[model samples]
Target: MKLSRFGGILSAFTATMALGLSGAGAATAATPQARATGYVALGDSYSAGVGAGSYDSASGSCKRSTKAYPALWAAANSVSSFTFSACSGARTGDVLSKQLGALNSSTGLVSITVGGNDAGFADTMKVCATDTESACLTRVAQARTYIQGTLPGKLDQVYNAISGKAAAARVVVLGYPHIYKLGGTCIGLSEKVRTAINAAADDINTVTAKRAADHGFAFGDVNTTFAGHELCSGSPWLHSITLPVDESYHPTAAGQSGGYLPVLRSAA
Candidate 1:
């Protein structure tokens, strides 16, 4: 009788301890990540979801796609407010003037994929696609030069602006993926061209990452997720000299859903 009572008490105590620990663990996990109530998507074509299709007519010339990573994240999280202000051909100045309007003290989250357009990504791809490897390398070299010299200051301005606008927001600066798979078959460009293109992407990402870190923002690099999925991998996530002219060399719908979405999710 006495022994039974003791065992019952012991079991009850153990169960209570377990529940207490479980509650603490839950709290620890939940408290670290601030709830993102309001989100603003900023930056250029990648952020606008240009090549992913499903364009929102309201976005007009911006070519904002409903399938972009920012949209996917907002839909998944069901944030209180989401502003998709990213445009197709935006540069640092564009973000400063047009996109910053969406940010405020109440903004809880921000995501951007800029610096690419500023680094002349579109023209670099155009050169790589239509010109010889020598020309491609030259264009890529110029882009890298811009990235090394001028991009840091531009990024600093934008990051500071974002921080100033959304004081408490958790900013996640997403990056672009390598366009081609080196050593793989290219319809027009060669392996050397692909390598140079990928190298330029690396340079931009490195610079962007440094700037993001300087501003205490998270840099969501999609390159790792995009590996084995670059164009000429037999399963490509990006477009190749695509139609509509604007879609060329951009991520396809699959790229947004599979590549970019996961990176932002993990960072955000």
Candidate 2:
């Protein structure tokens, strides 16, 4: 299958990480006295650290950022071995086919953020960012439909696959942060459109959380972790609309460190 054009753009936006850390509390997990020996990261651009500056050249087209939440958490926790397989535009299918090869019995930890692409999240965002409110609303409506109708099954399939491959690994499924600030103004995006986008995010999280629980995987809620620092907030952790477009609506490095890292660590 040909990659979605928007997926390529998303990949480019996440190719680097600009470092800064502030706001949000540390995520609390039951830290074992013996740290995990092997960690594997799986998911989409959010997990790959798209808006964060600095890509790992070794990761090639996946554009995995060295400063992404998974890498940061692995380093901070001193996990002895780490494999960052999360890609820039991965859907549930991609995880099943491409990313899961990194997992095995010895894998002690796994973290992922998926299902958004399967619901066409980037396409919705593009419509909202560049088109009229009506068009954006239509796109969001489509996304919500997919989120409700198809996303749960897709998430279950991926989560079940992960469980099968890494039975002993503590799996944590991460959700997406709200792309816009609630009750706040952003350039080009009207209040209604922003609300629709955020609502779509919430819908995705709801299904993802439910599926994770069904499969006995931990669900990491970044919504609470990212509260007060959404795009256009006083200290926004997510990048607002930007010139290159790919840079728009992704987590800044600070978001990965402060917002995502803490929440994922607490869940892990």
Superposed Cα deviation of residue 230, candidate 1 (Å):
0.5
Q: What is the C-alpha lDDT of each candidate?
A: 0.91, 0.86
The residue pairs in collision within model 2 are 14-50, 16-52, 16-53, 16-54, 17-52, 17-53, 17-54, 18-53
- Clash tally, candidates in order: 0, 8
Best by TM-score: 1
TM-score of each: 0.86, 0.84
Candidate 2 Cα lDDT to native: 0.86
**Model 1 per-residue lDDT tens digits across residues 1-268:** 9999999999999999999989998889878855548999999999999999999999899999999988999999968899999999999999999889978866899999999889999898888778777888999999999999999999999999999989889999998899888884667777777788898899999999999998899999999899989988889999887689989889999999999999999998
Question: Against the hidden true structure, what lDDT does model 1 obtain?
Answer: 0.91
Model 2: per-residue Cα lDDT over 141-205, one tens digit each: 99999999999999888888888988889999999988778675666678888899899999999
- Name the runs in model 2 displaced over 4 angstroms: 1-36
